[model samples]
Target: MPDTPTPLIWLAGATGLVGRALLTELGHEQPVLALLRRPDPSLPAQQQQQQQTALVDYAQPASFAALPAPSQVFIALGSTIAQAGSQAAFRAVDFDAVLTVARAARQAGARRCAVVSALGADPRSSVFYNRVKGEAEAALVALGFERLVIARPSLLDGERASLGQPARRGEQWALRLMRPIAGLIPAAWRPIRPERVARAMRLALAQEWAAVQVLESAELQTVGD
Candidate 1:
């Protein structure tokens, strides 16, 4: 009898906070193919050797066509309206690009998927950001994956400077104000480390769940911890 082959995992947004942590978590245990907007020469030589990478233009559907099929896929792609420079640009990445990748992965034989979403995601949300996230979630459910894990994490805590990304002033200020009274805040609303979110995503995907499973920030803290 032959030994079973390790599963190949497809990861998008490999440079982002949660994505980076998830990559580290996957380590050398499973083969990984990281799809990125550009080359990241900064990746450690060992990790580079362990993980395959492909540069992709999320706006271009054809970019994902060449990707090899995988059993599982993870999407951490997202951007704030400010970073995107306009609401339309933000939607292009957060909604359109995300669904594009998901649709492509599903076409490539991926049965299980995990996606990072914001805390207040709701399709009917009056807030544009939340509305977009909600719409993405709804659309993913409609894709009919065998197993889907949606992580809704509150204000992600990570070192953006280390990733060569600009700091979000609002997040910085909120962290400062919340730190001293963190225990007083609701667990669901409190700041969560990107690593925790990453862990929760991995753990959730490992389970046998039917249809969709949503992991809230509070549950992420417990399960991820």
Candidate 2:
């Protein structure tokens, strides 16, 4: 009998809060191929050197064609409408880019995938953000992966400034207002750390599943923590 080859994992969005956390969590366990739009100077040199990487423009389909085969993939790409400056621009990243990566990964031989989505996601949601998230989830489900894990986390808690990202005033205000009575809030609605979401994503991918698995914020709190 021959020894089994180690699985190759592909990760998109290597610079976001959850993405960065995923890099640290996944790198130690597998040979990860971190896909980035540009080089991140904020990433520690030692950490950057530990993994394989490919600079890719998600908008360019040709960029993903040369990717090495992957057994699993993780997508943490996201953006707010405010940051994107329009609903269409927001959808470009949250929906189109995300689906593009999943399609490319599937074509590259990936069978397992995990993605970061938001709470209150519903395909029919009137709210643009949640609707887009829901639509992205639906699109991934259609990709026919053996195991698909969608993590729906509440407001993510992380140091955006450290990552060279501008602060979200709404998020900051919500954190401040909730901090004093966090324990009283429902787990499903409570803000969660990006690290916890990343950990949960890793754990979910490690398990065997028939098809799709959805992790809500409450479940993430229990398992991810």
Candidate 3:
């Protein structure tokens, strides 16, 4: 057990858009242990000093045995169909990989998790992306974390240029059209900044509720604000 200081937070997807923002929100207040599939030498010295990384193969459960216990876990792992190159590839990252990390962490004594899910996620949905996200959510919930925060954000806007990551053109177009008429749209359907979603996830981290808590896009709008 940690003394005086807060327990470590195990963060996955620490290189992604929302993950980057969350790293800032947690700052130095909460110690973090980042789980990565591989080492990143390009990381700045500050990040290197602040957080320790544990490399674990996502496809193999045995690799997770190396992970230390964490009080909080954030599962931000995701991939687009375009980025993944195929439906199978996309599902492998968004669904299978996410659950693998969550299960391993659960077994390692992580009692809480904040998962980044899509706005329209539903296990019974016809849309493949939403369905996969929903399934991941359901699976994680079944693991019975003390507190599980489900953050459902719409189009995530961020400076992806820094990471050499591809922009989702479809989401960009939707955001452009919606920005002008944003007030006309429902709060849950509006575009959200990656930072906002990060803030929401951080808020979830602070809660000690013993039930599943869902932060919809509309609620996320206010939580981050």
Candidate 4:
């Protein structure tokens, strides 16, 4: 919209920890077309220089047509089942909404898409969360992007509490305890930082790639480093 000649990047769900980190990682190298449900008035002036914010309506396919034709798309959109309040609600965001956006991305001529998923994803998984994530990945692969990168991270280390998403009472405490012992765990299952995940997403998009690639938590550490 700013009439910049730089290649475009369309980003969704940029309020998340990984998304926030990606914003910094993108820096002033390229312009990012940030898709937001509403404008963020708190955006820093420097960030405003590099990002062009667009108001998005999730249900309106027409809005997708107005977005810059991106060479790549990054989707960090996700939600907890508890926060969604029901499995159906969770699927709407994690699966249905994601699929919708992917379709739009494909139509927008984006050659590559990098999305955040979780470990242990399987379409046939009995676990609702894993099943939903898997379904999303499967759907995206079926969309036939020139390159599709799925980043599956384990427990993400971040200052979520600062955002009012305080650690819950159960496994969250265990994750905090395990964070120190991450080296003792399997690389694929180890906890990783949101920054690392963000870095991995950017790196994956920059490669001369075709077909699909899935990055486990362990692989993210090296790429991010």
**Model 4 weakest 10-residue run by lDDT:** 162-171
**Where does candidate 2 clash, by residue pair?**
none
Compare the candidates by lDDT and give the number of the best one.
2
Candidate 3 pairs with clashing backbones? none
Angstrom error of the Cα, residue 72, model 2: value is 0.6
Runs with alpha carbons beyond 4 Å of true place in candidate 1 = 1-5
Positional deviation of residue 222's Cα in model 1 after best superposition, in angstroms:
0.7
Q: Model 3, range 127-192, lDDT digits (tens) per residue?
A: 999999999999989999888999999878666667656787877677778888878888888778
TM-score of each: 0.95, 0.96, 0.90, 0.90
Per-residue alpha-carbon lDDT of candidate 2 for residues 97-153, written as tens digits (9 for 90 to 100): 999899999998999999999999899999989999999999999999999999999
Task: TM-score for candidate 2, please give it.
Answer: 0.96
**Which runs in model 3 stand beyond 4 Å of their true positions?**
1-6, 41-44, 180-184
Q: Which candidate is the best by TM-score?
A: 2
Per-prediction CA RMSD (Å): 1.5, 1.5, 2.2, 2.6
